[model samples]
Target: MKHYPVGVFCDFDGTISKSDLIASIAYEFAGQAGRDLVRRIQRRELSVREGVEAIFRAIPSARLPEITSYTEQLTVVREGFDQLVSGCIQRGWLFAVVSGGLDIFVHPVVQAYRSEIEVFCNHLDASGEYLSIEWDVTCDDLCDGGCGLCKPTVLRRFKPDNDVQVVIGDGVTDLKAAKEADYVFARDSLLRVCREQGIACTPFESLAEVIPTLEQEVSL
Candidate 1:
């Protein structure tokens, strides 16, 4: 059997948690009008970028930090994620978080598992109680999809010459990276995209389901 260096990249929002933290924050801070806008974007009736901008615009000028604090309180890490991350680190695997979500939300989660993972995400700018987004889309120039952070580009950059690359995600934005990875653990929108696009992927409900499969792959 061959032993290859392995790198694991995961999406933060719906993948690692039961809900989308940023979306929850938007709902709380931006109120009903903002929630309506989010629905439109999710339905593809509006561009995601435009929808996000609208949400931020609707967010009040006094609840930004409060919303941030609320997010920290509401966010829950997925079951068994800590064990999966620990297992990977124990085996000397390189783990990274590649998320389109804001850094404010991603930071705390990554910090919880700090010694084992690194995070790359978009930044947020908040003044008083209003917020603006700083998108990291430069990686998209290398690919056709106008992704927020261009997950595939991040994979290509950090991909090891001697090991297989693995990506775990659950949305359309994750599809590009899923295609680029040697192994893709997909669910939700990403799984649907893979099926429609005829991309081979392993569907998983959680990281717990992925750990054993990865262990077998690495061992072999």
Candidate 2:
């Protein structure tokens, strides 16, 4: 019997890392004006794609490396993250990082478990003076939200092989995906959305709270 065959999809920004790396880059390179746009995005006044595009457009391409490096230097993966990965591995779970942000920073922060996790995130085009976005096609099917790399689509790909669907996230990008999950581990913005939308989710601040649930729920 497959004691643990759950597939897990996690959000990268505030969920895994201590904070939003892209937002840090935005505040630094996009300036105060870009910060305003980010707020608008957070407030749901602007779409995530548009707001992210505008922020990157404001940043000079040359600063991409500096911004990524700075964000990586400060990024602290949540305590128990590696342990969570190990638990998943031992239990036969597939853990994936599905982020709306670019891959440049995602890889570095999760490098220790590089081979363990599958990453589904956007790519950057920094050839010009200003960085440009080349959104990833993580799923061929489009979500109603029109997220370039739809998180639900990523889960769908693994659903066939995996008997259970699990998602952990903390922000706007996670809202829709959470609804589709059989189990949701949420905090911050995602937790709020789950409550408001009537999606049942467990609120957790660290991976430690989540591991036992995974270990106990042998079948979904």
Candidate 3:
């Protein structure tokens, strides 16, 4: 058994939640045009920031609140999330959500987790049903990684003294952080990226799969 100092940073949308809440909102609220833009972004034909801005711009203002409310009602936690989170807390592991998704969509999940986790995500500005994003311009301009919220930089700032960093995620935006982390648990796009890039990572289908390994590491 081996013990290592640990700090955990997790991606929110698809990693902790069963599906990508922000994407669901985009397709539902932004309609066809917005979905098309997102597809382009996913294919790398458009930058994430540009694509997100364009999609939001195409959506009618009245749909924002509806989307927000609908997302709060519809988002589902990934199976075994609460157990994993509770286990990490009990082990005294520092936990944080490092998401490129917007705060409006991520908030409900955070509330569900209560004071158990801290979040770093993009903020959305809404007046009634209209919505706009408040980009973390100060952080973005300094880091310049093209993420809606730069997860790696946030993790660095949040745990400057941490000796062992673990990043868990399921998307392309997670690549940078995976590179920086001491250990990584990857799935979906992030897993593919790790494979292609030859980055060492443990692959898992869900957070449930991650917990046992984490418990073992902490116990050691």
**Most accurate candidate by TM-score:** 2
**Poorest 10 consecutive residues by lDDT, candidate 3:** 136-145
What overall lDDT, based on C-alpha atoms, would model 1 receive against the true structure?
A: 0.77
Over 63-134, each residue of candidate 1 has an lDDT whose tens digit, in order, gives: 667877887888888876887788778877777788888877788777867765767888877764567777
Looking at model 2, residue 116 earns an lDDT score of 66
C-alpha TM-scores of all predictions: 0.85, 0.91, 0.86
**TM value for model 3:** 0.86
Per-residue accuracy of model 2 over 75-152 as CA lDDT, tens digit each: 888977887877777766788888997888787767777786688888889999899988875445457665646888
lDDT of each: 0.77, 0.81, 0.75
- Which has the greatest lDDT? 2
Worst 10 residues of 2 by lDDT: 137-146
How far residue 143's Cα lies from its native spot in candidate 1, in Å, is 1.9
Clashing pairs in 1: none
Q: Could you report the Cα RMSD, in angstroms, for every candidate shown? A: 3.4, 2.4, 3.7
The runs of at least 3 residues in candidate 2 whose Cα sits more than 4 Å from the true structure, single-residue gaps closed, are: 1-4, 138-142, 217-220
